[model samples]
Target: MAELVFDYLIIGGGIAGTTAAETIRQKDQNGSVALICGEPHFLYSRVLLPEFIRKEIELDKVMLRTAGDYKKNGIDIFLNESVCDFNSQTMTLKTISGKEFRAKKILIASGGRPKLWNFETLLPGNIFRLQTLDDALKIKEFLSSRPSGTALVVGGGFMALEFIAILAKYGWKIKLLCAEKYFWPDFLDETGFGILKDLWQKNGIETIFGREIKNSAELDADFVGVGIGLDRNLDFLPHAAIKPPSGGLEVNEHLETGTPNVWAAGDVASYKDRFSGRRRSGGNWSGAFMQGRTAGLNMAGGKESFKNIPVYAISHLGVNISFVGDVGPFDEKFGVKTEEIRFDKEKKEHIKIFMKDNRVIGAVLMNGQRFLGKINQAIMNGWADSKITLD
Candidate 1:
């Protein structure tokens, strides 16, 4: 119904989008920037959703940016507005509400959403999906009614563990079903998983590994929490090619989408990485934040390339875990090899280094954080240059 023209436009209101908008304003103060957020929220930290659920932090702490921040920066924010289609030729993007946005340059940082069991069919009863602040609030509300209940969380990813921890905090019994034999099957080795399993048991978490949820009705539980994975929002833009494996918009080193005058950041971008030797998506918080800044710089007429060695770390059930570089299983086509640093019996820790054709590809650390700096160096530069002596 209304047409909004801006010097630059961004799709998404998460940390990445917010960071980009702020960076753009800092770089080019006079650029009329407009950001479209699908959610009503201005900007909130997705990383702290579990903390909010556990009541470890106040809701105010979870909110990263206020309306005043945007107002002060002169960033025009269109909340609760989702872009439906983007036209590269006309440099116009149409929203679901028929609002059109035409900009000189655009950045798609739409991020990701929780994957429902069935997209076409309606979500079954008592099934929980945690991806937004609203979702966490609903979960908190649900827990308030039932003082004691059984929560069956399905998945081994970050959110699955978060669900178990939160439910346990609320004095609710938990049943965990991981899709793989071990938590982080691709990333962790025997000793690494053993450490996590021990932590879960210590916290009274009953885990059932290798059980993918096929039916919700068959399971007996008060509620089911699904944390399988997140899905990219690319259905609207068919013009941009979706890269396989990562399922994100393919971007060059500078976060430039092959499409003209368009760029991407956050989880939506499958950017070519110098360290990882592949086009990797910004799956974690640090990746999203850095990519947004990099993308914003390039969009605002500054030249910058993203140099990153992927690192994902989490603390749940009183144990710290980290996955770095290409932690997942390598493709069958590549001549892959693995060299393990083995577990430290005294330290109760494990370290496994993945190599492909004699190059340091990935490393998984479980309580063995002393080598973190060296592992990072190895992944970025080379193993020999890392100055880490492995026995």
Candidate 2:
């Protein structure tokens, strides 16, 4: 019996894995590329899960690429299969179903899994985490059965805000619980937080801060949407030199791990930012796409460095929020600088720029989509005095 082998083996079927596979095929047309995804579907936009859940878009609209696309590109895709173990020395991986695969090079784009709370009591059927298409489908099914009901949303990130907006749109009474005193404490300043809080309250949604649920019995709600955060999916490669940190698997500018011929991208790979010189992990779709392309190029003997500033934008409840660069409430020891430029407080139009050593590193653009391109360019060009105006 012989084991199956590929020129490149990719784990995870999200944007990162698919983009990398496409890149590899473009460069080496005849190279055998295999992508193993634990999920059942092909590449789809995880960011659009809220829309899918809201029934605003069909399931097909969320898909980024179809099986036909993969087949046309000559990339083999393994769906609904989980990789159980990896042997870096032998350059081989084994799945739970006792299937073994060997590859010359491997890229880990396994991304992140939803972080759920450990409750002593069994959770009701209405609880959901919107990470995958399956999760979105389940949520849609749950909501279909119960058209309108109270929902307790946990966490204070983009996912939480999106869920709250979706449920609220369906005429569901929503209560948002945040562990911090403000929304997205990492990115939002006091003024920005105040604006968001006002927006939520104006929608007739109760927004609570600095609250921790010790037990599931404390809140009475029809459903609970947990958007707390994500944990890296790197337990399969436990013996690998690249240790998994709380953030994700650390990689270099080339998106390569410490081990040779191995790389990582997307949510799982915490790589150094070429512009900001900071180690970051698990960014938005654009960043992940770029990282995957870079990883594929580097793995295929091309010297490509990932230098894009991570950006994420969301429109929820009549508010458009965009975060670019490093926009961090980072440790005081880092001396990260942040400046807020408010154009219209009433309209919640503003831009917050984060800097380190007089260089523009990151920004938060509230209702400021026009500035995204220019600001991203400024950061890449290392412009210290980049000026943004809302006219």
Candidate 3:
């Protein structure tokens, strides 16, 4: 007869929402907290989806926490429920099923959904996109049902590379279609691009550049894996809450949104970074995890600011590719200077450092994950050493 009320209501059950719920429960034992997740599965690592596809790890192993664990933490877990709308003024939200919930403090960690390329012709069920556990499971099923054949991976970003690597590992003929002139055109410089292209070609991955997959029938492949990009999941938010110039909800250093008692974290929140002095959206796991922790702490009345260097890494073809901090293709207004570093022949390292105002702001490391700690420290300490030689 009455709507349930919680002290802290977190929407979405990915890393950000779950982490925020855990943080809040730890700090305030008596505070009522609940997390509403649209998916049926419990908290699981999306990063390990590749391993799951390879069957190296079971489905249970992918789960980060069990239902019992959430109960032990005193967190109310709502699964298979989607929040359709929210009223910021009353701090209340309604699910698509008509269930209503009210909260004193709200954290939107809904994250992003895969951006699908629109085609005039309808797509077949064989095509796949990797963003959720269900998507991974469906892809596994599809692969198992059919014989190994060419997998046309469309896109040149991190997600595309990941799918390409996984398909290749499974002995599928992989053809990568790059919409841009080079791989990761927004982040990778010429040297890094060259290195990646050579590696991909060496591995027998036929990479075609300056092409877009507008029609499903363009390539003759057994299946297609689309990884164009992700669009932030923010359709439910009110018009006033959406940020300007960009669509994501704008949050300050503390992850607080313009709406009072409301906060945002993860991919959906375009936050102001204290370290970079820029407002940007972070789709990486590290940034989302830290943002959730910071938002939870701040929601619990703790004064905390998020100031960590964002890092994203993927291992492909025996090479470790990592991007740290503000490595995106930023405009000249940011006064960013990029320096490309190449190591010896044996090591085959390609490192690109982005510097702004004589301070290290971002870096792209290939086969050099070991240097991340030192580089992060140097960036935080304001080290301006432009020349980085790894012995």
Best by lDDT: 3
Give one digit per residue, the lDDT tens place, for model 3 in 296-390: 89898887998778888998878898888878567778788888655533566877888888888888888888888877876777778554545
Per TM-score, the best of the predicted structures is: 3
Q: Write the per-residue lDDT of candidate 1 for residues 1-391, one digit (tens) a residue.
A: 7789999999998888888999999999899998999999879988898889888899999998888999999999999998888888899989889899899999999988888575214445577889998999999888877777888888878888788888988998888888798887767777778888877787777888876656546467887888888889877888437878878888888899888889999989987666547667767888888988998899999889987777888777666677888866667676656666757755657778877656687788777667788888787776642345654
lDDT of each: 0.82, 0.84, 0.84
Instruction: State how far residue 70 of model 1 sits from its true place (Å).
Output: 0.4
Clashes (N, CA, C under 3 Å) per candidate: 0, 1, 0
What is the RMSD of candidate 2? 1.8
Stretches off by above 4 angstroms in model 2 are 239-246, 385-391
Winner on lDDT (1 vs 2): 2
* Candidate 2 local Cα displacement, residue 26, angstroms: 1.3
Task: Write the residue-wise lDDT of candidate 2 on 1-391 in tens digits.
Answer: 4688999999988899999999999999888999999999998998888888888899889988888999999999999889999988899999887889999999999888877577413675767788888888888888888669889998899889878977977889999988898888888888788778888878889988998887768667888888888877777877454453425778888898888899999988887677667677855899899988999898888988887767788997887998887776577887888887655787788788888898888888888888788788778877774455445
Off by over 4 Å in 3: 387-389
